[model samples]
Target: MNKRFIKGTMAALVSMLATNAFAATEVTVYTAFESDILAKYKNAFEKTNPDIEINWVRDSTGIMTAKLLAEKNNPQAEVVWGLAGSSMALLKEEGILKTYSPKGLDELRSELNDPQSTQAWYGNDAFFNAICFNEIVAQQQNLPKPTSWEDLTKPVYKGHIAMPNPASSGTGYMQVSAWLQSMGDNQGWAYMKDLHSNIAHYTHSGSKPCVQAGMGEVAIGISMASRGAKLKTQGAPLDVITPAGIGWESEAVGIVKVSDAAKRVVDWSISKEANELYVEMYPVVGHKDVEASVANFPNVQQKMAKMDFARMGNERADVLKTWSDKFDGKSEAK
Candidate 1:
């Protein structure tokens, strides 16, 4: 080839590369998914949809919810994946979510998707509150194994328990909501008041309490089943206890009312492939056909409380306010 022709070809190639890069859609996704699994989900999605890229903004559920609501006027997120259903419901009420039913919406369990005709969100997987009792730690502290939520308040367990702060953790909120629904509002608050006297301190993250328990920092952790299961598998000397009638929250996805890429992400999020990926980590997935049984994690559906999640979503602010007023000062120093 002539030197002039070679130079022209190189220039054209560079310009084409730039154009393609610009043409590839970049969707900003906000999520409260565990940091360890975020990259895996992103990679899995990108592998299938090579033309689109996901930019993840990850945090604890409460922080993610607050951030989305705060950015309501000028929304930045194109989609929300792995947020708690309660938070998604609140966002829907605030008019922050756009309705777009994913392709496999009918294939999902009826309770897993939004019931509205104009669906704003759909669940991917679920996680629920559980007690992580470290056998070694409990033995060391001369503590008995706690079998129920009521057992945690016993004097023998005083100052040997750690729990997440509801103000910050989705797991924490689930626990609180479950108690209220299961035990009635007045009794639940009374129970918490007694439990508060025995608590060592409340951590900000849901999984932290279980991690602390695994390391023998506390005898018991009021945390999630999946975290406790993972810790036990790693030889944490932990017992992952799924107490009966405990509250659980689905890790859900919703489209923000912005970006052309939002619908695409939402569609993929509820696909069979995505459901397969989600089940690898969570016991319950949106799709009824996808069944998961993580070792050391109990069958959550059998134990989950009959909660009115919509009511929980509506009452979230008030419940958190009541909890904060009662226990915020007792939280461990950050």
Candidate 2:
């Protein structure tokens, strides 16, 4: 609570926070961004804030969310960057996140602002569920193309599908959350039970299923639309199918208020330059004027569910538990 401490004591995340002889302040940042982009983000941010350096602690969305909740009393991270908005909402609900309005907040889409704590969190981009159908594998196996969520449950697709485990992935959680919201809880649970029968295995990483599908390891992969689109462009004989309507979540940022440097990072996270970086991988960004685009990615602006991130955050624990109990048997070796 006291902010009088020097470099190493402010945010509780600085293993190397320094004010000694021009040493840069190290801001501890927890993130779930894909591994390839971490260095780019760090380099760009440090270039802009030469006095402050980022100390990144990265993990999957579910792991990051659990870690933040676990460390709420003595938070190890000063900021959370590029995690699911629903996960950010959970942190906000637990009061693990601190409030700070960024510099370019007005330039971002109003709808991307968190309904629960606008000052605490804002989205950078959206990622939604998609079906990765391997044409080569399907042709070999005589599988019919699946066009909807229900189509995934047919006997023909049994033991041929791969998906992420919700307990370990935000994409998995959003898919489950979306089904419950769209199909109603009773039907949703029933739907999962049926779908579980067709699943060959569940992956730990949200990106893995599509990668596996692209490699012909699995005929179908329940994975993110962004990953699917990228794989398709790379000449993977895969169909990146965005279902008629599907679940989506924004990768968002929030502050932990351990130091002024943390606030600076949050500010940079929402800037126009940041949006430009985000849009290179994600087709939709918080910045309204950025005109986000992804090559070979389908138009999904109208297909996203009216997600209630607050509700998803609030219900996360219960939902994960139920999902694990019902479906963890099929998960790949962690």
Candidate 3:
């Protein structure tokens, strides 16, 4: 009855579909954020920003850093989100990252922001190292659960501990960096040598060590406290132990010199909504008003060693090389 009208409507529909597809922005983000939470944040952000899409490129922190560095001239990522703050600082020093402050940057803790506002990278949350002890395994082997960094070096723990390699894992570098900062260089290097004897293997991913311990693959995992807590909550016979002073680092976000559409994601990165999501895994977040709601979250404020991101960034290459020379023998396949 109305063949011409029907044809016109079909054409209009196709044209509208094409317009919307072209209009929507696809932002590429390279991140070392945990695999489990990637879907959560992506879904949440897209829900709020219907026209902006997130395409995540995920890897361990150190690997992601190297990838970004390798792609310096022809950047593939529009934004670098959830990489280590020190790594972001390093990128800023390399002139790889652009300077664009997000809308809510002032609401975050000033210390978590780049000391120079021109760098334009900011932390979202802090994660600290802890001992993930498989109590069952420890009891089976008659080994004591370690409560301090020094305790892992005892003879009983030899070849029963798993560690993250600082060369490939952000958590690993943070732990190594913190030790050096807190214990003095001479003592820190000496301490690592002692602990090196006990390590069963070093993992590329920070969370793998704890998962290995939870599975009874290793008795102890030197990893993030939140990881230990997550494993225990899943009914693993694991004890999440936080020592008196542990190394810690913040996960940060920065915009690459790409499309202006990337700024929307960076803006949402520091928002209260995003900070709330961060607290789902981390107890410490950059936003002062956002309280952590994680069940049985460790008290890490007093335990964190004083960190200088600038120093950590400057010394990263040297520290990683030395650590690799000393401990890379135990590392698992990349």
What would the per-residue lDDT of candidate 3 be over residues 1-334, giving only the tens digit for each residue? 5999999999999999999877868899999998999999999999999889999999987689899999999989999999888888888888888998788876998766788857569989888888888999999999987778899999999999998998877788888998999898999999999999888899998889999999999999988788888878889998888887687878899998656679999999999999999987678899999886666557777777888887898998899999999989999998
lDDT digits (tens) for residues 1-334 of candidate 2: 4456654364554533433657888899999998999999999999999999999999877788889999989989999999988888889989998877888888998666687544689898887888999999999999989888999999999999999998877778888998998888999999999999999999989889999999999999999888899999999999887776588998899898557898899889989888889988778898988875567787777677778888998998899999998899989897
CA lDDT, every model vs. true structure = 0.87, 0.87, 0.87
Q: Which candidate is the best by TM-score?
A: 1
**Pairs of colliding residues, candidate 3:** none
Q: Spell out the clash pairs found in candidate 1.
A: none
Q: Write the per-residue lDDT of candidate 1 for residues 30-93, one digit (tens) a residue.
A: 9998899988888998898888999999987778889999999999998999988888888888
Error of 1 at 285 (Å): 2.0
Deviating ranges (above 4 Å) for candidate 1: 1-22, 115-117, 136-143, 258-261
For each candidate, what TM-score against the reference? Answer: 0.85, 0.83, 0.81
For residue 318, model 2's alpha carbon misses the true position, in angstroms, by: 1.9
